[model samples]
Target: MSLGRRSVVTLAAAVLLLGGCGGGGQEAGAGAGAKVTVEWWNIVTTEPLKSIWAEKVKEYQALHPGVVIKNVPIENEAYKARLTTLNQSGKTPDIFTTWGGGVLKQQVDAGLAKDVSDEVAPWIGTMTPASLQAYQFDGRTYAVPADIGMVGFWYNKALFAKAGITAPPTTWSGLLDDVGKLKAAGVTPIALAGKEKWPGHYYWAYLAMRIAGLDALEQAAADHEFGGPGFVEAGRRLKELVDLAPFQKGFLGASYNTPDGQAATMGNGKAAMELMGQWAPVVQKEAGKDLGDDLGFFPFPAVDGGKGLVTDAFGGGGGYAVGQDAPAEAVDFLKFLSQAGNHREAVASGAVLPVVKGAEDAVKDPNLAVVARTLASATGFQLYLDQAYPPAVGQEVNDSVAELIAGRKTPEQVAQAITATAKSE
Candidate 1:
């Protein structure tokens, strides 16, 4: 069932035709007599997801005998650029993965996506309200989330034990104490790959959340009010962390691929922890280790007087959505893929937090189940800032974070630059 490059190209061409075939108001559940060809594009270069998607695609083909799925795995760095170009050329895939927050709003407004409200409504009541809201634009649904994840601290249990640390820290001061212990034990406290920019940017987002609360971070990113006391304090705290050398040597120059290779450093026992999304386990697996019994997780520690709550999570899922111009058959295939069972299967294979309710129970991996539980119990959820803001503003924030990490910009300079970008938008 492994599809070749030619098959992929052929499927993409069919998807293009399906996308250009407009004016037929056929429903998504059209009969099996119609053979649909769906061009499904996703960014899955990393492990677990890539292998998971490959399996899921095979299952989808078996279930829908007449349906042909064109799977295109886009590189993370090139996804946005290529997507934009494909969209402009009117060759956008019939069904593609998309972020579920304000990012989807832009596509909805541009009429690039189909309103899947009706198609997704049946499963709506089964999902968490926050999960449902993440995919909404103007009170209408444009996509169905396949996974829902939360950002938190992922630590190596073996490393903690070696350092004689018995429990995970629940407060800010406790976190610093643990970091000090790990540092004394000759272990890097955090594994940060700053060259990728977004990973370093995550530190800022979490710090901002701890200092100002979710509302302030949201407003600052959305409204550009970066001069507030909350932001300044967050920036100061970030600088303190940076000064501590919590990260590995030469971390600033290391890429995401570096962390994956340095698996022994983080997974076997060299690093104590990483502040990352729930997807860290997959990354660890890619590093050639099982990570069994050595993994543990905890929410980010609370800032002493900050307004943010420990229950607030920062992360969102991307899901598959059909194009408005897609052919009737392709649209039908998209709907088939959204069925509860299919969706759950897809998520379970990917080790992703499933958007469907029962899928959490279906998760065999304890780590993934922990992620699901966290997402299920979160009091509030915020999409990643880059995915929450307009593309231009997001790009500016990414660059600012990169410069901040490189020591090329002061905290004040980064804050001011972010505010300027928000105001200009």
Candidate 2:
């Protein structure tokens, strides 16, 4: 789902490499006067994380004189390629950013990630389980969860009024009716960056979760079969909205961060809403005119007879994992970084959505706070499928779902195509 960030990751031709605390040193000390270096690779190139992370590292290092923390903030796409190369070369950073889905699973499967289950157990209960969902596999944990968030509809309240939608719908049927009303009022009902197939896949993914339950998704991935009735039904529901032609003009090929893309369409009030993650408002403000107080948010509506609860959430967040060969100091540094007090400082930057329990109060943004609270109490949570499955299988889901959205495939066909890919993987 790009975590539904509108698929803005920039793929680079080459990876950025930086020299870290190395040179066959005995160790970068972590204990006072005991030098031990922890090479940490992360992708917080953007603020407030970029600045906030550096400050936290400094604080951690100050507390442990001999501990030198090397922070490397890499770009997203570059990180992926570079990490793949590192995995193939059988080397890993002491601590590195991870999403804890297919990629991390592969890394873990290949024995590249450290088993932090025991390390995290003592304080694990202090954090919300939903925030740690992606990092756990077969009752074992492999990473330290940092931030957690979900995806839903972000809409313009004024536009809703203009279209006579007194309130956001709470059911799938009501939502479809609202879409029809918006279209009847001649307003572009929705904004979608179809060029980024990940955005299109969210519709199918969420619907599947609502109808089949989160377990169904995990089961499908395990069984390498998406031919279940719930999978087909999810495609059908998505097709219902697509058939209504609810999206913006030329949305089929619209780029997300471009001047005239999905975020801009909603930000500029040319469209009523967009199905996106917590970062929706940020992108809206950046790419188009700010909607400010006029904007509102709501979870995806519940489907009738669905196995999933309305409180179920579908999303994931950026996290960090210890490498198989990283210095023990790396895990300690991560623990320091995730402390309630230290993590709360990041809330002020308005870039991160906190994962640590008791830090929700640090969130001052109204819309984001709503999301945070909802996630805190969510009855179930599912990480984005693309991030939760093998890379090949994940891409197949996106491609197949997009083809379904573009009117080029049927629900059954979509399910079959994805199943085929999963089996191949």
Best candidate, TM-score-wise? 2
lDDT for model 2, on a 0 to 1 scale? Answer: 0.83
- In angstroms, the error of model 1 at 107 is 1.8
Compose the digit string of candidate 1's lDDT tens values, residues 283-394.
6666646577889888888888889887888876666667777655555655555567776776656546677666667677777678787777778887777777765666
Relative to the unseen true structure, what is the C-alpha lDDT of residue 46 in candidate 1, on a scale of 0 to 100? 61
Angstrom error at residue 306, model 2: 0.9
Model 2 per-residue lDDT tens digits across residues 1-425: 22222222212233545333222223534344557778787777876678888888888889987778888888776767676656666667888888887777878888888899888778777778788888889999999888888999999999899989999999999999999999999899999999889888889999999999888998998899999999999999999999999999899989887899999999999999899988889889989988999999999999999998889998888788888877777778878887888888886567777788878888999999999989888888898888788777778888999899899999999999999989997
Which pairs clash (backbone N, Cα, C closer than 3 Å) in model 2? 1-4, 28-35, 28-36, 28-37, 29-34, 29-35, 29-36, 29-66, 29-67
Deviation from native of the Cα of residue 111 in model 2, angstroms: 0.9
Q: What is the C-alpha RMSD of each candidate to the true structure, in Å?
A: 5.9, 3.0
